[model samples]
Target: MDPCTYKRYHKHDQDSRQYLDHYFSDKSQMVFGEDALIFPIKSLTNAFAAGHIKGDILLDISHGSLVHHLYSACEFFKHMIVLKIKDRCILELKRWTDKRTGAFHWGHAAKHHADIEGKSHQLEDKEVKVRSAMQHVVKCDLEKENMTKPIVLPPADCIISTLLLEAISKDQDDYIRYLRKFSRLLKPGGHFMLLGCLGETYYTVGRDKFHAFSYSDDFVRKALEGEGFIIDHCKLQKRTAVSDLTDYKAVIFIAAHNKK
Candidate 1:
């Protein structure tokens, strides 16, 4: 596939519903349920529960309108500010957050969170916590020097971005450039958690193929190091699902703290 033929995420009209159904629906048998959903949920829950990441403010810059990863995080942070690049994604998230009539049902994801914490009975409460913690959803543009631009945000105690860098970046330079932008959002010594795929070139969503920047674990470590972040914990899960929706060799989770 030609690089120029790949659809640009920010410039295209993405079907948010199709994205949710393809990857996050309870009945769907896609690999995301195992690799993307379960892995991040378990990893984040464990990280938060162990007190590895705790703060008053958390800035989340994730791809799509997904909220499964924030279930565990809501409990640890007093406030969460989500930055989205697309209005469609923002609307999709608001549907769930505002509890609208046709909101996407994330009950299964909530249950998974509760099940892991052994609080199956409080499944309903889990979603409430996530909604409550998400205080703001702001629009962002990665190309801007200050992604959020005119609306300056307070430096966060921790910043978490899941599968967003690769989705938005067209190449390694773009990836590193965006990484620097993300790093600027955190305070000195603040933690940063990143979740992304390894060796992925493309992912399809609702009949549209989006480019994914391919990078290795070593490259990521060096990237963080170059940005003055101290590596703390890193985990890699080998791909186990058979699907044509995406071509990812593995999923990686890295937790680090900025030195500056």
Candidate 2:
């Protein structure tokens, strides 16, 4: 399925209760492994907090509304721009950042991130920081040459995406094409961080199923290298058990830099 249809299937916060509960809840660790979302969040937090990666602007390209992946890393950048495929997703994110009524509670994820940083008691503080760092939540069309058209954005120091390409690409070729489009939004030597589900073809948002690209570490490595990125980090975390919700074999996280 293309991004537009995929966007219709995708929901965030309250609308994505089923998706969040099935894939991101703490209980998922018993079936999907502890590192499903933990590894990427903690790793990015550690890297940025330690000065291993430095950046002034960070852009998050995600299918639905997802701020969990940006919580920790947002602290490292002065501005955070979120590019979403649908206006609904953008609105959901804006509700949270704008502190609107009935906003989905991200306290759980924020608390988890804070605990990882050895500040378990500062959940509220972390939430505030994440919200403050979220400077923009904009609409984007992935299939277009300029994803964020009409309003030009400065080249980002880092571009981060999670499970975005997998849900949008029809095959490896499409994945590469989308990857190159993302690269164009980054400055030279800028970092690209991605999280993907390995060997995944379909995932559920509510009652509907969405397509995801099936990929391996080798496929990903070759793709990034072929696009002129220098590999900085690569890791694959195997699943503990299989779930009917998805057919992913493992969770993969990669960090690479655009060649200067």
Candidate 3:
């Protein structure tokens, strides 16, 4: 299939519910439960616990309506501002934040988070903390000069973007450009944590196959360094589950700080 024919994430309509069901359903097996969900949660939890990433404001530019990753982050940050490219994603997340009747249940993911932290009894409190910390969910357009445009956001002390650049970028240059934009959102010396897939391409959401930019660990390091970020820690986990929903060789977590 020609690369151009592949659906561009920002340009096309995405089914937010289907995305949540396929990858984040409470019953999802190891493939997503382990690599996609647990891996990032553990990484974030450790990072926050070790005093590696923390601050007053955290900017989140993640894919879909998933909130599993934020369970750990809310403990470390006072406020969180989520930027989404799709209105559907914003609405889906709002449903959960507002405690609407049909919001997607993330109890399983929260339980795992609690289990890892040895606070299983505090599951309900964990969910409440995340919702309270997540103050704003604003729509953004990455294609523009300023992603948030008229609604200028304050420089965040930390930024956590998961599985978003790979899904939206068409090529390496585009990836770098987006990285540059992300860098601009951070204050000097602020931390940036990124979780994404390494290698492989094309992830299916519902019936549509969307493009995923393929790159390696070295490529990511160079990209971050080029954008004036100092790499602090990098962890790579080999893929353990077999499925056709998506093809990714490994999951990567990188923690870096913007250089002054």
Candidate 4:
């Protein structure tokens, strides 16, 4: 799609709450339970728990308002910076952080984190911890030379992006460009934890179809390597649900570092 077409599609109505519910709610797990959602969540938990990834500051450049992948990593970071491409997504995330009415339920994700840590009874406490760790929410522009404009943030010790690059990028070149942009936010030797859909071509939000770049594991590795990153660990979970909502073949979890 051309720039105009992409912008038109993006500007179209997208019910963030409904979209979040469809993918993140407890019921949605029946569709993306193990491979798409659960595996990535558990992998992050284990990575932090095992000391594979730990840092004082974390930068999350997520596509949407979802935070299911963040529960387990909160305790490892003193401050967390969350960035989004759209104001609507930022507002949706703020609603949850500010404890406003009509916020999507995140208890299930918190509970899942608690269970992983063997503290299942303190679900509320876990939620509070995750919310408190999130210190800033800023807007990001991938097309810009600097992803975060106006507000310059401290270089992060770790960066996390979930299903963001492919969903917004028009193709491989765009994806590579965005990956390089993301790397600029990190300090030397800083970690990058990326969660993405493998081989996905499209996804729907509120009846509007959005383009997704179909990518393989090798492509991701090459992109990271080209950007001067050393791959540390990578895992792939094959798709289980055969649905029309998306055409993703697998879910990929990768942990890499800026080459020192």
Cα lDDT tens digits, model 3, 105-176, are 989889989999999999999999999998699999987778888999999999999999999887899999
Cand. 2 TM to true fold: 0.89
How does each model score on lDDT?
A: 0.89, 0.78, 0.90, 0.82
For candidate 4, write residues 1-260 as lDDT tens digits.
34234332244566677677667777744366566567878889877777857778999987678788888888888888898878888899999999999887888777777887799888888889888998588887767777777888898999999988887777789889889888988999999999999998877666666778889999999999999999888988888876777789999999999985
Per-residue CA lDDT of model 2 for 7-62, tens digit only, reads 32333222444555566665624354355557777767765675756678999997
lDDT string, candidate 1, 126-230, tens digits? 988999999599999888888888999999999999988988888888888899989999999999999999999888887798888889999999999999999
| lDDT, model 4 | 0.82
Query: Which parts of model 4 have CA positions greater than 4 angstroms off?
Result: 1-13, 28-30
Better of 1 and 2 by TM-score: 1
On lDDT, the leading prediction is 3
Candidate 2: clashing pairs of residues: none
Task: Determine which window of 10 residues in candidate 3 has minimal summed lDDT.
Answer: 24-33
Q: Which ten residues in a row have the lowest lDDT in candidate 2?
A: 6-15
Per-model TM against the reference: 0.96, 0.89, 0.97, 0.93
